[model samples]
Target: MTKEIAVLGAGSWGSVLASVLDENGSHVRLWSYNEKQVAQFNETHTNPKYIKNYTFSESITAYHDLAAAIDGVDYILFVVPTQVTRSVARQVAAILKDRNHSVNIIHASKGIEEKTYLRLSQVLSEEIDPENRQSISVLSGPSQAEDVVTHDITLVTVASDNQRAASEIQDLFMNNYFRVYTSDDVIGVEFGAALKNIIALGAGALYGLGYKDNAKAALMTRGLAEISRLGTSFGANPLTFIGLSGVGDIIVTATSTNSRNWRAGNELGRGESLEAVIKNMGMVIEGVATTRAAYELSKKRGVEMPITSAIYHVLYDGADIKETINQLMTREGRSEIG
Candidate 1:
């Protein structure tokens, strides 16, 4: 019942997932490009830089060598940030290219790449070998690394067109504290995962502006509306937006202190400049990139997404956050149905 899982990337999410898999009685090869972090994990059993205070399972083998980390692995779980997905995938492909390994890949990160505007799954398809792409699956939901590392009850959806692939991933990830559900709608699940980060930024801005609960509530509701509109426009099931990856993801990202996107928005709302906020966060706020991608997606698909447009302007054009808010609020009133 044991499997080898190569976890590429050593960020908070990667460390947390490695801990989860190790606890679930799997051999986890926790690969980090940073040798120092790998040494830290091996010595202390804790990813001191990311998920602090919790010790990882001893079953985790931290490795600095990419090929060694992936060797003999049956499954690859990518926990790298969205921006780095391609680079990591390419490195992994080069290592696994020659071998006719029947490995399944699961991607946990969410975000569309800005310049190419390609989804994470798309990036994987392009970077990984064609044989491996058929076995690719995406795991996404309202889950956070901080909560998962502490063994908080978290539910996530593992989606792939291949039912067997989903079932395999669900078995690998399911445990007492973590529940995995399977869905066939990969596009829907992925879109929900990527787009919710944008709404979270909006919610964080409201919180930072001292807005009351009513304002926050309204923002979240409308945020979902815009996100679903965009998702459905692109052949994603509208119902998926109501599930874990959509509404569930939106609530967690918008409200949780662990959300990097929300933190960035809060800083912006508190009158800090976008550059200053990003510099302080020291991490990729996926929503920032998603905003630009979503804006482009909306224009290309003829779907209206005012919220994403506002965020994009504030982030890219040096527009004042307050001015962006006023622009949104002052838009010509129309029927909610329209």
Candidate 2:
């Protein structure tokens, strides 16, 4: 049977995922808040604004109307920026209140909320009525839209507390070029996904500063430790950190030039202002916001994330990159295990 799925957020990842679903024989409605972008997608079947060198699947319809896009769909996949998730959820909740059949909820957006500190799923659970939803899950890994759109082999994990929900999602996305794995560790997956971007920023800074492989290697190892430390503190399984959502994601995100967070950090390391980097990039750099959120999260939870702290200061406090690096190296020696 052909399934109908609503993919919210017409950005790079949304378009790519819609194409993936379409290729898997699902009818996909790609929704965007931008009317112009919707018209462009429906008319020209191209999206050069968010991602270049790719064409949208014409079989997938584009929608500016959220209710119309989602009506009667079996799934709603959110690829929106984390900051706007709450508002979008409220709208979805309103529409779903009158619906009889339940739709599964999933998000690929990675971030702990800035002020409230809620996960995107938590926000969805809070705003969306439970009776109207079947299960909430997250899809995350080291996927960059640029590579995935080109049909490079990609592996990602979709996690839900409900095993059935995870498997169902896996079936929808799995293909020759894209493989899906299922996990029950939503906390570890989400945290790992969100925290890695912060480390990737640090990694980008290292590369931009002309640091070589040694520095990159040290940063990645310690960054994983920091990620595990904070992740386990919240009752997330330690083993989850070594899985696709953890070390696997860290490897690609920290090393890939295709990462927006990496590119943003490279510009910052070259002494460009955050404003200029963001403006020139013309997209949301999730790490910039995640840095602030994680900085505060670590302090609130009493987790020692030195790399996150350093990047936080550099990003939010206007600290110099080299000086911060010096401070990090000069900190009193501690056990390697610590």
Scanning candidate 1 in windows of ten residues, the lowest lDDT window is 94-103
Score residue 274 of candidate 1 by CA lDDT: 84
* TM-score for predicted model 1 compared with the true structure: 0.97
Would you estimate the TM-scores of all the predictions? 0.97, 0.98
**lDDT of candidate 2?**
0.92
Can you give the lDDT of residue 167 in candidate 1?
97
Per-residue accuracy of model 2 over 22-88 as CA lDDT, tens digit each: 9999999999999999998899999889888777777989999999999999999999999999999
> Which 10 consecutive residues of model 2 have the lowest summed lDDT?
93-102
**What lDDT does model 1 reach?**
0.87
Alpha carbon lDDT of each predicted model: 0.87, 0.92
- Score residue 271 of candidate 2 by CA lDDT: 84
Pairs clashing in candidate 1?
none
Evaluate model 2: give its TM-score.
Answer: 0.98
For all candidates, the clash counts are 0, 0
Off by over 4 Å in 2: none
